[model samples]
Target chain A: METFSVIFQLLLALSILVVLHELGHFIPARIFKIRVEKFYLFFNPWFSLFKYKKGDTEYGIGWLPLGGFVKIAGMIDESMDTDQMKQPAKPDEFRSKPAWQRLIVMIGGVIVNILLAFFLYAMIAFVWGKDYVKNEDHIHGIEVLTPTLVGDNLFQNGDKIISIEDEPLSELMQANNKMLINQAKNYTIERNGELVNITIQDEGIDYMLKKESIVFIPRVPTQIDSVMPTGIAQELGLKKGDQIQQINGMDVSMFDQFRKELTTMKENNLDSFDLVVNRNGQELAFSSRFDTTYKLGFQNVFFLTHDFKKTHISYSLGQAIPEGIALAQTTLMDYVNQFKLIFTKKEAVKKVGGFGTIARIFPTTWDWKIFWSRTAFLSVVLAFMNILPIPALDGGHVMFLIYEMISGRPPSDKFLEKAQMFGFFILLFVMLYANGNDFYRWFTGQ
Target chain B: MAYYIGVGIAVVIIAFFMAATQKARGYNFWRYFIVSIVVVAGIYMMIENLVLNPK
Candidate 1:
């Protein structure tokens, strides 16, 4: 059921992207009086799920779940129908168009995708505004199971996190875990008012961020607010009002200590552990086997049941447009930076994820706000991916058009065909690799 | 299999570079060799990513 829901959401998102992308071409073609043979929601090479001819255009949904297209008559694309090239070009045909017009037609999908991302982002911003958790605001300090071994010095309890790579603590966590793990950043903290500099240990940090259920800070309350069904704490016979005091014979003083001890246990076979709880003014002992699947399978009822201090700023109509445009630009820049990282940095390589990772981005429990945010983020990604100068994608066609415009001659059909074939293979390999990562994560329970 | 895919990716990337400079005469062998080296590097990285000791 979960898989189906994920697939359904993914398909919906893809379909929205495809429709807008194809419409980008279709609308432009019609405006220029060009003949559009078909408008498809997905590629329909052999067969289509449904199609209908209306006013010289056959509209349809393709069986292939890959992508969609608008077939402009007399255009050279994936459909390498050389027979059309053999015939003399007609006035309304794509081949009959001027260089500049053809350029726009070729780049139609990419432009639409970019616009869609911008629009979605703007709308989301207008509706939901923005939310962020400041690093400094985590005044309780970060709790880690593994003692942070920075260079030679080991950081212990109540060690204030001031910054990463000389950055302010507020700014350090801005880029999510990317700054702490995959990318190295220096840290400067005001520990005991004597300023100390620490280079965040990336190796262990990367593992902690990527590993499932290993939270940078846990959500469990300091006092046991409630017990959940089948939960490790509950199954071990801990009561709703019980206060956790110790784990594994260590006398834990506070909730932070309890969390710190549980988190750093890397061994796979940690089956059972002892927990001493204070219940009804009495200390009681209980032992329970931890679920090997995830490090922990408990949610804090206290935290989950209450709302955080929300800082939602609703912008005026005038403010939203500029904000949206700026947001879109920032997102586009981030995508470019990420792409460049694939070439410049080695750590960035491991961050590459396929559909499984994509699917995991969705919330376990559906929320419209989260859904739109993810969709907007993905829209930006889609725009960037399509704009890459690869043969089979929209960018590839745009590249050819640009070359033709500058060189006073179009690329040879032979070269174009070869490029298309090569592009298809590249895309295939990427899909396989990404999906393979998902499969590995699933089976290994990593 | 991923290693081979990485190799394939490298080959295509090299092919792209080779194609881009096709008009530049007399470097076909060097281009292929350079591209082959790129492919090898890519293979090494893929293996490293896949099989390297997990942190």
Candidate 2:
């Protein structure tokens, strides 16, 4: 059922994007009187699931969910209808159209994708607003959670993060993630009102790549928020609002420390275990005889478990428009930065995922906010990818058109066909490799 | 999944047949070799990178 929700969202998002994107081309091609042979969602290899003929076009859904295409007459698209190109160009064929017209038809899909991204983001902002925890909100500051974190001397306890990888920290919730995402080796922290620059050693990278991913934890005390009825904590006279300061005579200041102490106690099965709690400015002690579970039924104050305060602000439609556009722009830039890392950083390439990875990002339960946000991000990615000058893509056709406009000559049909095949193979290899990686990881439990 | 594998197997066999026919039609040996290698290399890459690559 969880997998179903994920797959359903992915398919719905892809289908929407593909259909709208094809329409971007379909509309312009129709305007130019270029006969569109078929407009199908997903590729129809051997046969289509269902199809219907309309004026000069066959609309259908293909069994293959890879992608969709609009086959314009006299065009050497993925359909690769060379036989149609063999005959002299007809009046209503794509080849008979002006070069400028052809360029617009080629670029229409990318333009639509970009606009769609902006629209989705704008709607998201207007409906959901933005929720974040600013860096300044982390009054108690953070702890370098990565094991050994370069060394003991680099970051002092309760050090406020100033910046990472030279970028000022904005969202405290995302600070640790930003560290891993940027593959950062250096950061600035404010200790005792003085800024210090710390450069992590090579071991830090290994920690980010191989082990527990979190790089920092907010320094906060462990305070009980609820006492579970008929459980260990209630039986031991532990009540809510008890700020646990020690367990098994070991000092525990933070919530993470409390959890760690519990785990250690459970593993060792120590005969004597006690909790030291400060309740209402009064110190109290409680004994424990934990079973294998080592479960303290009292739940911690989850909201206060972190240091930062969350902020959410809604926007009017007018304000959201620019905000959404800027959001889309930044998403595109961030995606491009990450994409380039695939070539520059060895570790980055290893992390590349396929459909499985994409599916995992969706919420297990239907969430409109996250669903739209992810889909919008995908739209931006689609726009950027389509605009890359790959021969089998729309950008390929535009590249040829640009060449024709510049050199006052179109490339021979045979040449375009060869280029298309070369580009198609490269694309096929990339898709298979990424998906194969997914298969490998699933099979080997890597 | 079975359909996908079936298509892949069919494609490989047909490609080999086409390459042989191209040879009969006076295509260069290098052309046929390139086609075969590309098909084989593509499959090899998927297995090597995703499953077999050392951590």
Which number leads on TM-score? 2
How many collisions between residues are there in candidate 1? 4
RMSD of each: 9.0, 5.8
User: Model 2, which residues run further than 4 Å from truth?
Assistant: A45-50, A148-153, A165-167, A181-186, A201-206, A224-235, A239-241, A248-250, A259-271, A280-282, A289-308, B1-42, B45-55
Find the candidate with the highest DockQ and give its number: 2
Off by over 4 Å in 1: A45-47, A144-160, A163-175, A178-184, A200-215, A218-221, A228-256, A259-310, A344-351, A443-446, B1-55
TM-score of 1: 0.72
Q: Model 1, A1-446: lDDT tens per residue?
A: 77777777777788898798788888888888899988878656446789899998999887656667677888766545566767899999987888788878777877887888778778877887877555554444444444444333544444556765555655223434444433645655555667676655454444544443232342333466566676676556665567677777875645666665676543445667877778888988877677765333344334333233434578776787788888888777767766776675565555678877887788666678777767777878887898789887888888988999999998877788778767865765566566556767787877
* lDDT of candidate 2 over A64-87, digit per residue (tens): 676777878888875456667899
